[model samples]
Each structure stands twice: as structure tokens, then as C-alpha cells.
Target chain A: MKALNRYARAVAELLVLFALYALGTWLAQALGWPIPGGVVGLALLLLVFALNGLKPAHLQLGAGLLMAEMLLFFIPALMSLLDYGALVRQQGLRILLVIAISTVVVMLVTAFTVDAVFRWRMRRDT
Target chain B: MTLEPMPLAWLGLTLLAYLGSRWLYRRTRIYVLSPLILVPALLLAIAAPLHTRYAEYSADTHWLMAVLGPVTVAFAVPIWQQRALLVRHWAALLLGMLAGSLASMLSSWWLARWLALDPAVALSLVPRSITTPFAMPLARDLGGVPEMTAVFVMFTGVFGAMLGGVLLRWLPLRSPLARGALFGVGAHGAGVSRAQEVGREEGTVAGLVMVLTGLLNLFAAPVLERFF
Candidate 1:
């Protein structure tokens, strides 16, 4: 009976996600592809969703909830920084610089690449 | 290791803290800043001042961080659904990733060393643009602390979400695909989420970039480590 409800569907989707991830992971390992198993799992799930008519529109509740509480998932990992506290204390400035610069670089590069692609595509079309 | 009650308690407390921060931030019209981004930061900022050691807090929360891997794996659902767009841009994406990642690594490295940062910290900083889940493990494996990487990645996310648009305007790039891809690849989760706010196409590109960038970082970090 629960399986017929929205909550049930959400759970089922999550289960399917996990199963697909395992399958993808296994397949990649078997095939010796450089890609991660989760990537493969994602591809598989995307296929199923496409064929079966499941979409982001359908998973709104679960996805919204997941996004809303997304920070909850980072807590344990945040704790891991404790191991690096000494390093941070000793070289905090350097660490800060790296993070800041890398972020800027990524942002600029992405923007440029997209811009270039768009310009190229438009030129070709003309 | 034996499963302890603290692991559960840590999760419970983290949930409480996150919810509490969300409620307070929402009521204050600070919609742009969420508890998820701020609270952990507040904890870190005030850690020494509050006399609450990260070591103590981490002892209770390590298992919670471990969940990031599985949660990341969960992203497969959205990705799977978006496969059509991915195949369409396969070649462009591949080249863009190589270019984006190489630029990111070299720039971060050059900038940090120019600023006279230590090697370990520099290593930590290299992967800040990737999602925290992937960034943390790579950071840890590369001799950077996962927690430090988490904080760094979050900072990058918050910065991207907060200032990316302003930066986007100032830049000369006119292609939405490249811009969106850069947002996702460079900013990781927050960048992608922020891109979603701009429009559908941007979000799609951002999501694609996040996936490819993650894959690239998985292999690229080891090669980059040699230079450090």
C-alpha cells in the first residue's frame, strides 16, 4: 500500500539510484573504463528515467528535501578538517590563497570557454 | 571499528544546527546566505574563540562526512536523466574539461606559490573547485585533510554563488554553453545550483560540467601532485 504513495515512490527512486550506481560501478570495473561507477550509474538511471517517464518534475519533493538539507551531509566530512588544523594554523594564508585563486581561475575559464563555443556555433550557423 | 552512539548524535545535532540556522536566516531576509553554508563556517570561525576544538567535534562527526560519497553517488539520477544533452556535447565537453582543469590547477598553484603559501596548503587549495564529496577524498589521498578540503570547497561554492554573476558579466565570453560549463566545472555544486537560478540552459551546462570536471579531477590530481 505504501508503495503506491509519493513517499514510497521517492524511496523506490533512491533504491533504483543505488542499484544503478552499483551496476554502473561494476560495469566500469569490468570494462576497465576510466570512469567512476557512480557516473555509469547516473547514466543508467538517466536512461531509465527517460524511457520510463520519470523526471525532475516528478521527484520534486525528494529532490527539494535533499537540496534543502544538503548541508547535513557535509558535517562528518567537515569534521575531517580537524586532522589538518595544525597545517591550517601554520600555513593558513597559503591555503586560503590556493582556494581563492583556484576558484577565480575556474570561474573565468568556464565563462571564456562557453563564450567561445557560443561565438563559434553562431558563426558556423551564419 | 565499533558503531558508537556519538555518530548518531553527531548527525542529529548537525541536522538540528542546520535547521536552526535555516529558520533564523530565512526570517532575517538573508535568503542569499543559507545555514548550510554559514553555520559550519561559523563553527570553524568561532572554534578557537569558543574553545570548542575541531578535534572534539570531528570525533563525533566523522561518520557523517563519510556519507558524502554515497550522497554524491546519488547524483547519478539527475545525470542519468540528462544523458541526451551529454552525448550531444561529448567532444566539446571533453576538450573544455581538459582546458578548464588545467587552467584551474596551474592558476591556483601559481597564485598560491606567488603568495608564498606552503606546499601542503597549496595541495589543499588545488581541488577547491570540485564538489566537496570528490574534492575531500582527493584532498585526503593527496595528503590534504578532508575537513580542510570541505571548508575550502564550500568557500568556493559560496563565493561562486555570491559573485559568479558579477564576474560573468565582466568577462568577454559570449557562449552560454561554455559559461554554464565553466560554472559547473569551476564552481562545482554551488556553481551549478547558482547556474540553475540563471536559466535552464545554464543549469544543464553546469550539471554537465560538474560531472566531467569531477571525472577529470579523479585522474588529474595524481599527475598534478608531482609538480608540487
Candidate 2:
């Protein structure tokens, strides 16, 4: 009975989060915004949280639950591997190589540049 | 006798598999054993041997995917938690993200062209560095296939999550904030998760960078299409 009540509360909290996302999506559509409804929803959530309209504790349990199991959400997308069999067969090696190289390059470039700028600013301030 | 797979069954299977894999990861502390890698492989192994079609599996598991948008929205909580860091470094962080975003876009474009990939495929690759939710629509707007963009985004995420730490060690990035931003800008959600494992401040910065880079990409996609 205790476990059941906890589960019920979690479900309720998740529903509240979902409702906020739905409202954000609706508003984005209504406004004809180029941004995605979910992202708009995220922005709204951030705004509310920043302004103390909602407390972090309110979202902690539900959001943590969702984020913890986040990878499960991508299973369907991964399953789409079945659809891309042909593309994978023909250009799989090349695609893999490009992705691998580009990932490293992007990581290095972004990190180095950001660090450089930060260091330069520090030096200038001193 | 064969039994039809019900939606509840699929949901149960996914949750079980994810939990099982996650438990293994916790016990071993092995990066490769992570649910991101293990769960998909385990499901693929099961589905392949059983000859279950992707569409059928997806049909039953669609509820899991349906919650992704709301979960994404909920990321704002973490960002909100780091509100102080965001306000302090807003100017420098935004400039870094803009630079990083441009670098990602340009490198993908050049690399795709150098490999002589099809125009549509190359266009799809343009948004490969951003998160999936943002990448999908940006791909469509830029005349790229959304599906291909999704695949690319996954590839980028997996690569960053798996090998990013090693790369960071080799690079000159000593500050956690810079390392976190790099992961977020380069790897998106998976990288942010990895960053979170490192430290709270690191994770918060990475999450902020990921969201900002994604938003920047949304506006940059159209302008980028003309150049590519």
C-alpha cells in the first residue's frame, strides 16, 4: 500500500510536467514560432523555475525518473537501423569514419577555443 | 503456440532490459556496459533472432518515445539549478557556443563534401552535432532527411559519450567548465550525461551549452543551407 501510494504520487508529478510541456507546445503552435514545442516548453520551465514560480523539488522526482530512463526512449530510433540496412551496407565504413573523425575534431576544436578565450580574458584582467 | 506481443509486454520488456543493463553497469562501473549501448544491443539481439519487425516493436513501444518531448522539456530543471553559473558566464558562454556551433556546421559540411556524399545526405549531416529533437527539424528545414539526421546525431552522441573523457585528457582543457561545454556542444545529451557523472558544475554547464547550441542551430540551419 505504501509502495502504491509512492507510485501514484510519481505518476501525478509526471503528469504535471507533461501538462506544462503540452501547454508550451500549444503556445508555440499558436504563435507560429519556428522553435520546437518541446524546446519552447523547456524555455518556459526554465523561466518558471528561475522566477520561483515552481520549486526544484516539485520537478526533482519526476524529471529524475524520466532522465534516468532516457535511453529507453531512443530504442525506437535505434530500431530504425532495420530501415537503413541498405545505406549501412553501401556506405557504412565511410559514414563511420567520417562520424568518428568529425566527433574528435569538433570536441577538440570547441574545447581548445573555449579554453583559449577564457585564459586570454583572465590574463587581460590581471 | 506463439503469443502476440502486447503493448504492455513491449513496455515491460524495455523497462526490464534497461534496468538489467543499468544494474550491470552499476556493478562493474564499465562505460561500455552502459544502458545506452547495452539495452539497444540486447533488444536487437532478441528482435533479430525472433525476426520481429522494427515497425511492430515500435508500434507497441511508441509510448516510451512519446514521453521524450516532455522529458526534454524537464531538462530545464537542471538548467534552472545552475542559474547562478549561467548568469555569471552568459556572455562568454554564448560567444563560445556560437563559435563552436559554426565550427561544427562548417566541419560537417566540408567533411561531407570531401567524401563526395550525396547532396541530401550531406545536408542531413550538417546538423549531426546538435541534439536529436533540434536536429530533426533543422534537417528537414535544410532539405535533409530527418531519419538520417537522427542516425548521425546518435552516432555523434555515442562517440562522445564513450571516448570523450580520453580526448579531454589529451587536450589542453584543464577547466571543468570548458571541458563540460565542449562535451555539451560536441556530444549533446549523451555528453551531458557523461559530464554529469564527472561533477555537478560540469554537468550543469554542459547542459546549458547543449541547450544553447541547439537553439542556435535552430536559427542557423536555414542560413547554413544556402552555403552548403
Candidate 3:
């Protein structure tokens, strides 16, 4: 009974999230906002949390599952590469090289910069 | 559109491949076996042999992509809960996002010249690090195909997620703040999920950073258009 109840709660929470996403999508379309509906919905949820209207636990199970399996959502987009034939044939290897090298450099620079700034603050606080 | 027989089969195959890959990754702890790399590679290999068209495959599985929107919204929960930590690390987070976004655009531009890529292709490549929603508009305004830009964004994201962990091992990142920001800044959307596996703090911080990175790029894109 308890496990079933927990499952039900997660489904309910997911539905709530889905509702917000739909509302945000509609609002963006209706208002001609430059932002995506997902972002608008995120802002709404942020407002709710900021106002103490909900806690993390309220959406924990559902959100956790959604996020953990998030890679599943991205595979389709990556698979779209199959469509760009001529472009791929000509620039595929080169583009991949550029992206690969740059992504590594960007990750390193960002991580080091953040670490340095964090340490500087720590030293000041001390 | 409704789920037709072919797309439905493709969808089921996607799910099975991902689940199987996830299991292999857990069992063997191989980086390549992770869903980010394995599932896409598996599907793409199968797709080519079957002579599947991109349009049909994309249209059939469109709903999966649509679900990304709600999953993105779902990020708000962790971001809200992690407000306290975020406040404390504001300075680092801000600087890191700025540096990361600039590095991404600049590196693409710098490297594109060596590749001798056409001007338009180069522009699309520049915004590859930003999420598609923001990157597409930037690409369009800058005389690149938004569709091509989407593909580049996907490639960068998948690569970033793959590299984030490998990079972590090499860096002496001591805080969840540092570790999480690495993925968020470097990888964007896909990185957030990768960070979640690291820990809740890392996940929350990554969620916060990815959204902030998107907004930062969106704002800077206008100033960038003039320069491009």
C-alpha cells in the first residue's frame, strides 16, 4: 500500500509539472514572448518555491526519474545528424574536430576559473 | 501527430537500446557504453542500414524531444532547494558562466578559420554550446541555418557530457560548486543530467548554471550579431 501510494504521488507530481509546462507553452505562444515555454514554466515553479508554496520533496520522485533518464530525451536530437548529408560529407570530420577540441578547452577553462574565484573568496573570508 | 506503426517501433527500439546501454555502462563502467554515446551510436548504425530517412525518424519521435521542455522545467525544483548554496557561490558562478560562454563562442570562431569553413557554417558553429532554443535564433540572425545550428548544438552537448566526467578526474575540483559548474558551463542541457549522477548538490548547481548560461548567451547574442 505504501509503495503504491508513493507511486501515485509521483505520478500526481509529474502531472502538475506537465500542466505547468503546457500553461507556459500556451502563455509564450499567446504573449509572443521570446523565451521558450519550458523556461517560462521553470520561472513559475521558481516563484512558487521562492514563496514557500512547495518543497523539493513534493516533486522529488518524479523529477528525479525525469532527470536521471534525461539522456533518453537527447538521443533523438543527436540522431538528427542522419539528415544533414552533404554538409556532413564535406564538413563532418572538421566540425567534429572543432567541437571536440573546443569542448575540452571550455570545460577546463570554466572549471579552473570557478575554482580560482571560489578560493579567492574563501581566502578573503578567512 | 499521432504515433504511427513505424515511429512507434523506432521509439520502442530507442527505449530498449538506452536501457540496455545503461545496464552495460553500470556493469562495465565504460565511458563509451554510457547512453549518451552508446544509444545514439547504436541507433545511428541501425538507422543507416535500414535506410531510414531523417525526416521520418524525426517526425515519428518528435514527442520525445517535446518531453525535453517539461524536463527542463523540472529543473526548477532542485534550483529552488539549492538557493542557499547558490547564493554563497554567486561570484564564482557568475564569473565561470561568463568565461565558459565566451570561451565556447570564441573557440568555435577561432577554430573555424583553421578549418576554412564557409562564413555561414562558421556562424552556426559559434553558438553550438548554447541550447538550441537560444542558439537557433542567434544562428538565424547571424546568417546561418537554424536547423544546422541545432545539429551542431546536439553534437557539442553530447561531447560535452562525455568529457565532463573525464575532465573532472584531471582537475582538483574540491567543491560541488566547482564540479557541477564544470558540466553546466561546458555541456549545458545534457550536462545537467550528467551532474545529477555526481550528487544532488552538483545536480542543483548544474541546473542553475545551465539556465543562467542560456540567459547569458541569449543576452550577449545581440551584441555578438553586430560583430559577426
Candidate 4:
């Protein structure tokens, strides 16, 4: 019974997640909002959680379990690189070059800029 | 028009990949180089020899990617839950995100142009730091290829999560709040997840920054494209 209940909860979490996802998509499309459906639904669900008053016990298990394995969902998509191998080969050097160079650039700039802004804010506060 | 069932083929593959990643994480301590990135890259190399095309595989699986928005938005829950922290850090957070977003955009553009990449390819890289679903579609509209954009987005996620903590340690900066915010803005969903693993306070800030900047990039991207 304990195992069965756990299964049901897992299923329920997925159902709510996907339904909210679909609804968010539907609402966004219908309203022509700039935000995506999944994002909208997630936001809506968060609101519901806040208003409904969640129990730490009620949510901790489900959200934790789902999030713990979140990275798993992304794997299938990366295989798309194989289909585009030729383009990647032709553009391979450039793609790698761009990704490599831009990654460092993005990382550094992001870190520096974020640090600078915080420093500026701290100074202002004081 | 006839609609088909969600592709079981892709779903199955994702499941297998997930299993492999879990096994790896258990055996190895390389939490930084996540299974999501490594497993797929491994699958690609091994399966490429088998000639399994990405398009055919992604055809049905693309539905999975399509859910990027909700998955991303769900992150807002933790962000909202930490509303007090946000209010406290509002000034610093906003200022940091603004600088982070612009710096990310400019650096990506500069690198793209310097490499003389195809304009579309260059455009796609601009949003690589954003989550895949949002970045992929936006890249397509701006003349970037979805498949390629997907690849870079994955790479950015993996790199950010894996090296982000280690790298941040070496930097001169010293605030967990700032570090988490930077990770979210620069790395998006994956980074936010990694930030959560590191600590709750950082996770909260990172998750909020990711959502806010993702929304910002929707606008920032087009303007940056024009500038390029």
C-alpha cells in the first residue's frame, strides 16, 4: 500500500506538471503572449502552491524526486547533433571555435558584470 | 490532419540514457560533467557508426524539447517561495542581471563575428546560454538552425553546471548570492539546478535570475541581432 501510494503520487505530480504545461501553452498561444506555455503554466502552478499553502511533507518528496532526475529529460535532444553531423563537420571547426571562445567570453563577462553590479549596489547602500 | 502518439521511440531512448547517466553518477564522482551532456555525446558517437540519424530520432522526440517553457517556468516556484530574499536583494539582483545579460550577449556576438561563422550560426550562438526550448525557437526565427542551437545550448548547460562552481571559486568575487545569480543568467535551467545542489540560498537566487533573464533575452536577443 505504501509503494502503491508513492506510485500514485508520482503519477499525480507528472499529470499536474504536464497538464499545467499544456494549459500554459494553450493560454499563451490564444493570448499571443510572449511567454511560452510551459513557463506560464509553471508560474501559475507556483502561484497555486503559494496560495493553497503547501506542506513541506506534501511537496518535498514529489518535487525533489522529479528535480533530482531533471537532467535525464535533456539527453534525447542532444542526439540531434548526430543528424546534423555534416553541417557540424562543415561548420565543425567554426562551431567548436565559436562555442569554445564564446563560452569563456560569456562566463567571464557574466561573472565580472555581476560582480561589478553587486559592488556598485553595495557601495550605494552604504 | 492526423496526429500520432508521442514518439515511444524517443521516449525509450531517453529512458535508457537516463539509466546510463544514473549508473555513471553512482560509480563516478564527476558530478560536474553531467550525464545529460556526456550520455548524449556518447550515444551520438556510438550510434553515429550505426548511422542513426538525428532528425529521425529527434522527429518524435522534439515533443520533449517543446516542453522547455513549462519546465523552465516551474523553476519560478522556488523563486517565488524566496520572495523575501528577492526583495532584500532586489537592487543588487536587478543590476547584476542587467550587466550579466548584456555582457553575455556582447561576448557571444564578438566571438561569433571573430570566428566568421555563418550569420545564422552566429545568431544561434547568441542565445546558447538560454534554455534549449526557448533558445531553439528563438534561434530559428533569427535565422539560426535549431539542431545546432540545441547542441550549443546543451554544451552551455553542461559546462556551466560542471565548471561553474570550480571556476567561481577561482574568481575574485565572494558572494554566494552573486555567484548563484550569475550562474542562472549565464547557464539557464541546468545552471539553476546545479546551483540548487550547491545550496538553497544560491539556488533561489539562481532560479529567479534564470527566469528573469530568459524573459529579458526574448527582447534582448532581437535588439542584439540587429546590432550584429
Candidate 5:
């Protein structure tokens, strides 16, 4: 009975989340906004939380469940590889090289730049 | 065997394979064994021999995709939890993310052009640094192939998550904020996940940066298209 109640609550929380996302999608479509509905939904959720319209606990269970299984959502994208076999074969190495080098460069640049800026600010203040 | 029943079967297979792969990743903690890498490989292996079409598999697994919106929105909870940190370092974080995001876009454009990729393909590569949800629409707006943008975004995330640690070690970064910003800017969702594993502060800052950078890129994409 306890487990059943918990499951029911989870379902209810998930429903609320889905409804908010749907509303966000509707708003974005109605406005013809270029931003994705999911992001608009994120903005809405952030506003609601900031204004204390909903406590974190209200969405915690559902959000936690989704975050824990987030990787599952991406599997389809990876699976779509089957459709891109030819493209991958033709330009796979080149694409990989660009992604690899850029990722490292971005990481190094961002990290070091931020670190440098923060240290420089501290030194100036001191 | 029936066509109508196949979606359910495929869904079950996805779940089982993910669970098995996740268990192996947990037991070994090997980066390559991570579920993100392994499950897809496992699916591709099964898919080829079984004659499973990507379209069919995707249609069957659309329910999982549907949850992505909510999952993206759900990220707000974590970001909200880090509101204090965001408020304190808003200037630094924002500047860092903006620089990082621009660097990612410019570098990708330069490399794609240098490599002489198709113009459309090069355009798709421009938004590779942003999270997929935002990157897809941005790519579409810029006349790039959204699907190809998704692939680049995923590859960027995986590479950032996999190599970010090794690269960070060689850098002179001692601050969690700087490290987190790097991961979030370079990696998107996967890098944020990796950041979370490192420390709470790192994860929180990374998540905040990821959200902010993604939102920033939405506005920046149009401006970027003019150059590329």
C-alpha cells in the first residue's frame, strides 16, 4: 500500500511536468519562436521555481527519475546511426577529427580563460 | 512477429540492453563501458544482423524521445538549486560561457571550412557545442540539417565527457567554477553529468553554465549565421 501510494505520487508529479512542457510547446508554437519547446519549458520551470510558485519537492521525484534515466533518451539519436552509415563512411574520420580537436580546444580555452580571469580579478582586488 | 507488436518488443529490448550495459559500466567504471557508448554499440550490432531498420527502431522508441522535453525542463530544478552560486558569479560565468560558446562555434566553422566539408554540413557543425534541444532548432533556423547537428552535438558531448578530465589535468585550473564552466560549455549534457561525478559544486556550476550557454546560443545562432 505504501509503495502504491508512492507510485501514484510519482505519476501525478510526472503528469504535472508533462503538462508544463506541453504548455511550453504550445506557447512556442503559438509565438512561432525559434527556440525549442523543451527550452521554453525549462525557462517556465525556472520562473515558477524562482517565484516560489512550486517548491523543488513538488517536482523533485519526477525530475530525479528523469535525470537518472536521461541517457536512455539519447539512445535513439545514437541508433539513428544506421541511417547515416554512408555519410559516416564518407566523412566519418574528418567529422571525428573536427569534433575531437574542437572539444579539446573548447575545454582548454574555456577552463584556462575563466581561471585566468578569476585569478586576475583576485590579484587586482588584493 | 507482427508489425504492430514490434514496437513493444523493440522498447523492451532497448530497456534490457540499457540495464545490462549500465550494470557493466557500474561494475567496471570504465569510460568506454559507459552506457551511452556501449548501449548504442550493442543496439547497432543487434540491429544490423536482425535487419532492424533505424526508422522502425526510432518509431518504436519514440516514447522515450517524448520524455526528452520533460527531462530538459526538469533540469531547471538542479539549476534552481544552484541559484546562489549563479548570482554570485553571474558576470564571470556569463562572460566565460559567452567566450566559450563563441570559440566553439568559430573553431568548428574554421575547421569545417578548412576540411572543405559541404557548406550545409559546415553550417550544421557550427552549433555543435550547444545542447541538442537548442542546437537542433538553431541549426534548422540557420538552414543546416538538424539531424546532422544532433550527431555533432552528441559527438561533442561524448568527447568532452571522455577527454575533459585528462585535458583539465594538464590545464592550470584550480577553481571548480572554471572547470565546471569548461565542461558545460564544451560538453552540454554529458559533460555536465561527468562534472556531477566530480563534485557537487562542480556539478551545480556546470549545470548552471550548461543551461545559460544553451539559452545564449539560441540568440547567438542567427548572428553567427551571417559570418558562416
Candidate 6:
């Protein structure tokens, strides 16, 4: 009975989430908004969450399932590399080098900036 | 027009490959063994042998891509879960994200230019630091290949997460906010996972920062694409 109730609640939660997603997508397409429907739905859902329309506990199970299995959904996109043979063959090594250097740069600069601001705030507060 | 038939067999193959690779990744904890890399390699190995084009594969698996939109919507949950951190560190968060996003964008463009990559590939690199869900759309808006952007984003996440750990040692980040922001701003999804291993607060902050960065970039991509 406990497990049943939990599963049932999860189903309801998933319904709400999907509904918001659909609505957001519809609105985006209809209104011709620049934002993606998923994003619009995210904002709308966040708004609902803030207004106390729902609790995190209510959506936890459903949201967790979707997010945890997300990699499953992206496999095809990754596999789409089957398409760009010429590009990959010609520039793959260079693209990798660019990604490595840029990633390191972003990390160092972001970390240092955040640490600086944190220390500055602490000093001002004191 | 005749619709392409549902690719049940290919779908099954794709699923088995991804789930199996994930299991393998868990056992090894090696980045090379990860599903992101393993799944693609596995599929491509079969694909090339069979001469399966990407369009044929996508026709069968687009349902997975369609769900990506809803998966993206689910990010709001994590961001909401970390509202207190969001409220407390808005200043640090905004400044760090701006610095990181700007740095990543500039560095990617310069590197792409320095390497003389095709113009399309150069633009795709612009959103490489963000997570896949956000990066793919942004890449398309900028007239870059979305799939290629996904690969670049994946590589960025892997390198950023790996390098973020090394940077943490040399940097003077006392607070969880700074430490997590390092991963979040640097690596997005992959960094969130790495940040979770460091500590709970770091994980929370990293997750929040990642989601917010994706959102901020989504809102700004329209204008930023013009620059690219």
C-alpha cells in the first residue's frame, strides 16, 4: 500500500510536469517567443514552485526518474557523429585541443573571480 | 509522404549500448569508459559497418530527443532545491558566471580561429561550455551544427570536470560557493557530478550554478549569436 501510494503520486507528478512542458512549448510556438518551450516551461514551473503551488517532495520521484535516465535520451545525438565523417577526420584533433585549452581557462578565471568576491564580501561584512 | 518506419531494432541497440556502457563506466570510473563516449563509439562502430547514416538512426530515435525538452524542464527542480544558496550567493554567482561564460566564449573563438576551424565549427564552439540540452539549441541559433555542438559540449564537460578538480587544489576557494561555482561555471552537467563528490553544499551550489548558467545563456543566445 505504501509503495502503491508512492508510485501513484509519482504518476500524478509526472502528469503535471508534462502538462507544463506542453503548455510552454505551445505558448512558445504560438506567441513566437525566442525562448525554447522547455525553457519557458522551466520558468513557469519555477514560478509555480515559488508560489507554493507544489512542493519539491511531490515531484521528487518523477523528476528524479526523468533526470537520472537523461543520458539514455542523449545517446542518439552523440551517435549522430556517424554523419560528420569528413569534418571529424579533418579537424577532430584541433577541435579537441581547443576544447581543452578553453575549458582550463574558464575554470581558472571563474574560480578566482568567485573566490575574490567571496573574500571581499566577508571583509565588508566584518 | 511515407514516414520512415519505426526503428525498433536500432532503438534497442542504442539503449542496450548506452545502459551497458553506463554500467561499465560505473565499474571503471574512467572517463574514457563513460557512457557519453562509450555509447557514441559503440554505435558508430556498428553504424559504420552497416553503413547506417545519421538520418536513418535519428528517424528511429527522435522520440528520445523530443523528451529532451521535458528533461530540460526538470532542471528547475534542482535549481529550486538550492534556492537558499541562490539567494545567498547571487552576487558571486552572477559575477562568476559572467566571467566564466565570457572567458569560455572568447577562448573558444580564439582557439577555433587560431586553429582555422571551419566557420560553422567555430560558432559551435561558442556554446561548448554549457550542457548539451542548452548548447544544442544555442548552436543551431548561431547557424552551427547541433550534433557537433553536442560533442564539443561533451568534451568540454569531461575536460572541465577533470581539470576543475586540479584547479581546486591550487586555488584559494574557501567557501562551497566558490568551489562549486568552479565546476558549475566551468563544466556544467559533468562538473555538477564531480562537485557532488566533493561535498553536499558544493554539489548543491554547483547544480544551481549550472542550471542558472544554462538559463542565462538561453536568454542571451539571441544577442550573442549576432556577435559570433
Tell me how far the alpha carbon of residue A100 in candidate 2 is from the true structure, in angstroms, after superposition: 1.0
DockQ of candidate model 2: 0.62
> Candidate 5 — which residues are off by over 4 angstroms?
B1-7
lDDT per model vs. reference:
0.68, 0.79, 0.81, 0.69, 0.83, 0.85
Compare the candidates by TM-score and give the number of the best one.
Answer: 6
lDDT of 4 by residue, A1-126 (tens): 999998898777656667777888899899987566766776677777778755334544555555556566556666767767667777777766666556555666666766776777778889
> What value does the lDDT take at residue B166 in candidate 3?
85
Put down candidate 4 lDDT per residue, B1-228, tens digits, no spaces: 111244465567666766877787768857643576667866676667767676667666666665455455456555566778778778677777777767666677777788777787777787788766567666765677766777788777776776687777788976777778767877777788778887887787787777777666765655655665
Instruction: lDDT winner between 3 and 6, please give it.
Output: 6
Give lDDT tens digits, candidate 2, residues B88-150: 767667777887787777778888788877788788888888887788878888899876787
- Model 6 CA deviation exceeding 4 Å by range: A1-4, B1-6
Candidate 3, residue B128: Cα displacement in angstroms equals 2.8
Can you list the residue pairs that collide in candidate 6?
A: none
Tens digits of lDDT, candidate 3, B1-228? 323455477888889999999999989977678887888889888887666776767776778877777786787876777778778888999999999888988999889988898787898888888766556656876778776777788778778888898888888987788888888888877788789888988877887888678767766766888877
- Which segments of candidate 3 are over 4 A away from where they belong? B1-7, B130-154, B161-176, B189-204, B219-227
* TM-score, every prediction: 0.79, 0.90, 0.86, 0.84, 0.93, 0.95
Report the CAPRI category for model 1. Answer: acceptable
Q: Between candidates 4 and 6, which one is better according to lDDT?
A: 6
- Chain A vs native chain A, TM-score per candidate: 0.70, 0.88, 0.89, 0.77, 0.89, 0.91
Identify the superior model by lDDT, candidate 1 or candidate 4: 4
Q: Candidate 5, clashing residue pairs?
A: none
Name the top lDDT candidate.
Answer: 6
lDDT tens digits, residues A15-115, model 5?
87888889999999999986678888888998998788999888899888988788888677667777777878888899888899888888877887778
